[model samples]
Target: MKQLQKLKILDLQDNRIQGLIPNDLCHLQNLGSLALSENELFGQILTCLRNFTFLREIFLDSNKLTSIIPTNLFNLEDILYLNLSSNYLSDYLPPHIGRLKAVIQIDLSVNNFSSNIPSEVGGLQTLADLSLAHNRLQGPVPESFGNLISLQSLDLSYNNLSGVIPKCQKRERTPPQTELLPTLAHGRIAYQELLRATDGFSDSNLLGTRSFGSVYRGTFTDGTILAIKRLDIMTDLACALDYLHHGYSTPLVHCDLKPSNVLLDEDMVAHLCDFGIAKFLGEGESIAHPNTLATLGYIAPESPQERINMREALAALKKIRHQFTQAVKGEKHEDCIALRGESVGSSSEP
Candidate 1:
């Protein structure tokens, strides 16, 4: 591989390749692109990869690669795309990540990364897509993230992050006309237009219904079909619970948090309707049992015996959401339920 100094691109993606990336391949200092994704490759990314100054893209996702990211890899200022997701990489993201000034997309999710996300990531002015989900990251999200002016998509879910997410300012610059999709040419539609599109939201157009709201299949005169969801209830419910549990001076717990207590306004924003059984906990207090119990099958299994705090309830809700998401993706999530059952059973012991 060292003899191939003129090799500009090395793409072996989706192959049956196994074993460590050859150190000899790093000798291709003039390489412009490297793609080895969806393979069985294991071992840390080659540190010498930093020497490929001319490289513009790197795709090493869906592999078994482990170890902390090489700090020098961030020095590739001209690299446009970088994907290291679905690996076993562990350790704090280096602050030098901001050095990728020209990077457009970055994916570092599904790893063992811990600690606060580097605030320097906000410096990637040209970044459009970023994902750090399904990791072990902790601490509040960086406020500097609001500075990502060109960001179009971001995912930071399924982590241990807390605190309010900073709102990102809208981008001032319009994308080039060449980049606009044909569907976007119609611009925004009005409520009456939506009603017409979904044929008055007839039962024939109904796609599905969940704890939140229903989804309908809408069709335009031009035959463009789209799925429209009515309300953003789940997010609103989560925010309400978070405020009650953490934002207030005296932590409040909605003892009965069933779907019936969730109401939606004309704007489709959910509001917690009934607080008849709410409980306020004093400082240093964690659990509180109200005189009235929540609806059966709605609260946790141990709720009846040992009352749980709002934080625990929120955690349980998130776990259920995660399990449901996994199941929808055709993944096995019985282990999560089994583990929860084991913990509940052990805690009930005398």
Candidate 2:
């Protein structure tokens, strides 16, 4: 390894290298990149990384390395990327992990690290992508995280995090380039106006209920209409809502879509009102065959060999609804359920 001192790039990934990463590998002082991921390496990471002063990127994921991250690892001020995901690394990340000022991407996901993300992580003003998914981490995300103005992708999913999500804060900005028309009063409104408009979410404003919580509609003092769905904490509704808004790489599956669980805006535009049973697609996550449909009135008389997509089911139901001369609202409306339970009704929730 001493003969490779002049090498700037090393690709040892997927090599099934066994035992500890040799300390002498750090002798390559000119090395700017290293890839040792997807190997069976075990034992403590060598403490000699501080000598690789020019190293800008490192990939050590998918290894069996143990022990806390060494304090000297962050001495690489020129480092711009780090991937330590999918390892047996344990213990809380040092608060100084954020001291790697040049790191623009970090993947600490799929590890045993527990505890809250340190607030100092917010000081990484250049961070664009940060993934802490699939860990034992608990506690609310640090409020300082919102200070990452350059952040475009953030993943704290599959953790034990709790508490309401922090709302975006106000910052100084120039006046809008375009003037507001008489019809357009203001550019934006505050959430407090929404809470007050719902009369503190009195039941009279309630529009629907789901496994998570209830949905309400309210008109602000400014005549701004909004729908607020207050979900229960124990139901993990906050994470579910966040996933629906930002985590999915594809359109999500809301298998239990129903009128009572959906809220309509003033223009009749609909936003998903309940996330109690939401599932992200394109990630190998599947819809619960019976539980999902049962809540939406698709309880099958027999086990299905293949799952039916919601679009196909809705199309078939529309045909049935069009054929009904009496115009049954749906198979699960109180009156319709009574009739169906008596074996005299047809069609299900659309």
Candidate 3:
């Protein structure tokens, strides 16, 4: 095995291959994709992979691995996907992870990583999806996350993260930090017309439900289809009110945007409705407390602002639609019309 070189792919995933990854495995300079997930593997992984300069995708999740992620691991500029979730990893994540400029998706959920996520993580330009959920991470999320312009989806649930979410546009600040975090753009419900087409969110129009609300299928007068969200006004009023008031020029936060808050019209357009907690933004207005906003779920994890009105909502919706577009192989919005509306999954919001 000493002379074998130039190997590009080695996949030993879902196997009983125990013991430390052969230290000699790094001899292959051409190695790109390595899958070692779902095993009893232990010890630090980055050094084991240090020699594979060309590595792109690495899967080391679901193992017995421990210790902090090595800083040297981020030296791989070409890595696009990395998974280290579901393990016994502890300590704070490497601070300069943004160095891996090409990484697009990363999952570090279900681990023992503690303290605040580094502010530098917002520097990862190409990152689209990131998850750090189900961990012991604490402290306030960094306001610098507004720098992640390419970021589409983020999950920081089941953690000790605190503080208001960041906004897209900056409002005037009073003290402490004179700089106001970016304001979140409002979300656009393009499928509002579709809701009309579906007969105003009827029982026949039901699509799905979650802990916060229920979504329905609808169609516009112009024959456009959309998804209509009917939120559970009884439960999430505090969040709904906070968002509408603090997060907008006029304050229009949804307070509870979940699967149920989304709906589809006859034309297959998606709409977010149910302004039960929708608030009008103004100075000194209190949805609940001046320190925090809305429920825990549905609200973006990094946002420190109070508003998530039309523009921000639209941005999130576009991202979701983009994900759906890729999942159904270009369904053109109408191809995957299933009759079954799934039950609403529970949300993390209070």
Candidate 4:
């Protein structure tokens, strides 16, 4: 630990590492991903770990860890994913769990954690998945949890949790707040306004037809010329999609991406639109729900009993990610494809 000053990822998971989790590891302040899951480790999750300000993930599940979860663990604002599930961890659910402002997924399931759900859990506006299943937790779920409009998958089953599910309202989708936030959410015309801009979406203004919708050219009252694709975004879409895939707490896949779902800006930057078919690829998830085989061919085709693999989906995302990286480096589009192809191909491997 003393020699590797620049070590960023310490993935010691799935090993026979035993005894106390080293409090000394916390001295490595630059540590970003600490994955010590699936080990013979025992003892409390060291409080010293809370000081690693750069730490973004903490995976210590499937261990013999005991005692209360350290209170200050939630104070680390940069943490994106946390999993302390399948341990001997006990004590009441911390009310300030919502203090993990940047957290996207929390899985403290299959433990002895008890008590009512915290109302403040809703304050985690960026949280997408919460799993407290198979625990001894009791009492009704907090109604305030309804404010978590960003939550996609929630598992309170197999616990003592009772009462009606909270009535949450849908809100604007907020991807990870990168430098590209304003590019996606800030400048937007109203739906009705789009209709008027495209002259009632008439065929005269239509630029092309897509598998799902149409694309058109439109001008606003301010004389701003914008390409009106039936999609939700432009080049910003690629950025956001890349963020959604690799930047978030968990892997996500946008199943429907094509020309119709892409918009072009005045500067010719492309953005993605409509995540009506996006899937969060968390542990033990499925793709076998109410969707057709139509949206799986832009990168890989589904032929003669050839099923599309999840790696192909990840490759598509990697393609977008590498594309943005090359563009930022001002590389030629043609040269970057080979570089991106190798990168995406390697990433698709097990």
Q: Quote each prediction's TM-score.
A: 0.50, 0.48, 0.47, 0.52
lDDT of 1 at 338: 39
* Runs of candidate 3 exceeding 4 Å displacement: 1-3, 46-48, 168-350
* Model 1 spans with C-alpha error above 4 angstroms: 174-350
Give the backbone clash total of model 1: 0
Model 1, residue pairs in steric clash:
none
Model 4, stretches more than 4 Å misplaced?
Answer: 172-350
lDDT of 3 by residue, 249-335 (tens): 443444565668655444344454554453333445445333334443244322345345656664544444443334345644431
Best by lDDT: 1
Per-candidate local distance difference test: 0.74, 0.62, 0.62, 0.68
Question: Of models 3 and 4, which has the larger lDDT?
Answer: 4
Q: Give per-residue CA lDDT, model 2, range 118-176, as digits (tens).
A: 88888776677889889888998888887776576788889999875554343445466
lDDT of 4 at 11: 88
Candidate 4 structure quality by residue, lDDT tens digits, 1-350 = 77776666788889998999986786787776789999989988888777777677889999999999999887777577899999989989888787887688999998998888878888887788999998988888888888887789999988888888887766755555543323335655677778877899875565443322346667676655466777423434555454444443344566766668665544344545455565555544544234323342232222214345757644554455456556655774443334323343211100
Can you give the lDDT of residue 5 in candidate 1? 95
